[model samples]
Target: MSVNAQPCPGPQPDALVRVDEGAIWRADGKPFDPLQVAHTRHALSAHPLLQLPRLRRLALSLAGTSHVKYALPNRKAGSAFHTFSESEAKMSIASTFDHIEEAGNWVALYFLEDEPEYGALLRDTLDGMKAQIEPRDPGMHGYSLFMFIASPPTVTPFHIDRENNFNVQVMGRKHLRVWQAHDRVAVPDAAIEDYFVHDTLRSLHYHEELDARALDFDIGPGEGVYIPSTAGHYVTTEEGAWALPGGRVSVSLAMTYFTTQTARRARVHLLNAFLRDRFAAAPMPPGKSGLVDHLKQPLAKILIESRMRLYGQAAPRGMSGH
Candidate 1:
């Protein structure tokens, strides 16, 4: 999709945040509480991604043009729903990635790595996170950052992400229902394999029975929620509630980190998939085999690098992004 690449019309300050084991703190060195977020929406509006000038330009950049995905409103009335045909959904524009919406329940996912300012911002932000996250793994790991902007009352279908995500809410309010990362019932092994290895869509199926076990909460501006890798969750943007005058415009930043532990686990999944699919072997859980884990990690790393090289050669020049 696209946005008006106009100059920023507001201030350009970055958030000063620090993360603890279970909570996030702001500049004052205190837990950043969301109890009063409704009153602070406008005051907490300094996110660089939301700055008009930068946002518009970034939205039109290659990242925005190539990796973008859009969905027309799901007009279904019930709470529990499933995939519907395009005819059952609202009339959508062409599948091309060169469109943008100004109103209605619109949504956009901007590939942040394509924007230079965002690339630098992500590096600096991850640098700040080193003290908090580095203890998990001494070796450096690659990361990705994406920005999401949605209009009011939009419901992102339930899904599981492949990497550890720190979701920062830049504007408006959102209610997120998340399940534990290791909950096999909520997330099946096949689903994980499809995402990490097969490059399928990140979304997962939803079951009404799983709702009772979910930990649901509301988040607002200047606040964020940590979503563990492979955790199942869904997002619902509030409808003009605690948002600006027009339809609620919720802007969020998603930081995804691939630590060593993540890499090892991904290797395990890849190995298990090979054994199961090729050799007809029994399923294997991650972190279960020291020998296999040891051998597969470097192998996985090599395979990943080779694939990247092949993809790089085939991809159009200058299309690479984090």
Candidate 2:
């Protein structure tokens, strides 16, 4: 299908996400909370645009672009994450896609909103969730859609992200384990601050012991889960759960956005990092002290803006380092 082709024939308003009654609720049985983990269902798994051929075309279009990343598959769940160099993959992207099932590769297409058709689909999906998201986490921005296509027996390294994510499985089945967003034991405050400051994941390490505290989900096509910002998580696609007949290639998409609360938290973390690194001050972690957090927010913003002006470095999406 062409990039502009609609999933179905005829003119109809697209509603990519489907949240049935009780589809979104916290464990405490409170009203819908965006910051908490919630299982959801979506129509994108059946969307024509996400089919392998169309995705291969998208990958070709994104070739040599920063938005596309290729990695060698990690068989061990605890292995560190790294990108594949040009020398490491001596094949064209199309060829890689052709052999993806047995190539032991993982490909990611980021910022799908920048593309024409995917952008429209992403917008519709997010718009469908506005009523549920806005009331809980207002001012959502920096919308991003990341598509991951990986071979079976591969693992996405355990790590934390800055934006709240709605991850949907498009094909195959994968085991997902997620920890709480505020679980400092899984991810330390210092590591989070370092991520915002340096854009690195070197400090975040995974240990098998963390499994005891994880909420695990084994999901297939049309199934999904909501993961709060900074939630430590990892995914593994098993060898036998391929949805298609030929190969065990797993496809998934992560739709992420930043809210007002996330923006504030980013600034606070940036400020804390500065204090710890430059001033030898051990500032309280974000959300730890209300008054102190409020006091640090503006100062952090000023610091970030000044740095941007002086260094020509744009702040992370939503102006929050995530």
Candidate 3:
């Protein structure tokens, strides 16, 4: 019901990304082209948000806090996974504000216009809905949604995402040094399966130490980093800050974008929904309707996994390193 958007579609997919740039992030890092990448880092000095400790705290709480996962593209996983040890399928973070509704998966109904967080997130979602250079409705894209999870000290047991994402850090800090995706890594379907079944980090074998596409520095407040769609990456939080007497937390923003393929996928899904309601609904009996699921669920998984392994690592989609 946000006036910001002409109409609302879908539900409960409330935790993937924000669309705009922090001016400085773009100014400093290089990757401006849509196809190529641009990765950058910032120290506490680079961010302005730190001046407001309350907001900083809120951001930290959002990160350290966990949420529910939604149905991710097929990576040989279960129906749904949780966010904190959480859900992955259409993941949702607990929103105190009603606008950021939580139907639990793929259904983040935003209450933007009223709530600041949801509103900010919704606007970001709209920005990424379609490329500014391209001509297409916002609905034309298949997007991803993920809320950054912070684990102090330990290596982020690697994984990939359901869609392309730019994991930008807003507060605290963590290092996720990753390798480009390669076919050489041998990850058993079982390991991916285990991730789904247990909603835990998938087990993978990187014959070599993880690749150093870049050694991700601890992204301090207001700082963010870019990533490719469904690209795999991981992180390790610094010990100093979190180890401080009272300790600080890490909260990063995930910017999920819609790719050409995902846009088409979304379009197909929408058309299927329309047809099902208009033509198929009356004719088909209950429980027999396939609608878009028959195509979407499988395609989602395939695409997610494919993107993750594209550079050739061959590991499960969500585990680190693309």
Candidate 1 per-residue lDDT, tens place, 1-322, comes to 1111212122347642222222232323433221111111122247545654555555555432444545657532223323333334432323221333334444454457556667666666666556555564434345677776666667877777666677776666667777777777887777777667775644356778888777775666656666767787787776655344322567777766666566667666765666667888766667567776777666555555666697753311111222
**lDDT comparing candidate 2 with the true structure:** 0.75
Q: Model 3, clash count?
A: 57
**Candidate 3 local distance difference test against the native:** 0.38
lDDT of 1: 0.56
TM-score of 2: 0.86
How do the candidates rank by TM-score, highest first? 2, 1, 3
- Candidate 3 is scored at a TM of 0.45
- lDDT string for model 2 (1-322, tens) is 0011111221123433342233222323355576576665555665667778889999998887777776664546566666663445554677778888773567788889999788877777777667777887888778888999888877888888888998887776677888878888998988888887888878888989888888887776666778988888888887766544533888889988888888888888898899999999888987788888889877998898898899998885555543
Please rank every candidate by lDDT, starting with the best.
Answer: 2, 1, 3
**Lowest summed-lDDT stretch of 10 residues in model 2?**
1-10
Number of clashes recorded per candidate: 3, 0, 57
CA shift of 60, model 3, Å: 14
Error of 1 at 232 (Å): 1.3
Tell me the spans in candidate 3 whose CA falls farther than 4 Å from its real position.
1-37, 41-116, 125-145, 149-151, 181-204, 212-215, 242-247, 262-322
Question: Candidate 3 lDDT, tens digit per residue, 1-322?
Answer: 0011111111123322343433223324343433333454333222333222433344334432333222332212212232232243323333322222111112111111233654465345435434432352233233344444332443444565444455555545556554332222433333333343233544543433445343344445544555543234555555565653322555455555555543343333333333444575422211134563345445444544675578553433232221
TM-score of each: 0.70, 0.86, 0.45
Better of 2 and 3 by lDDT: 2
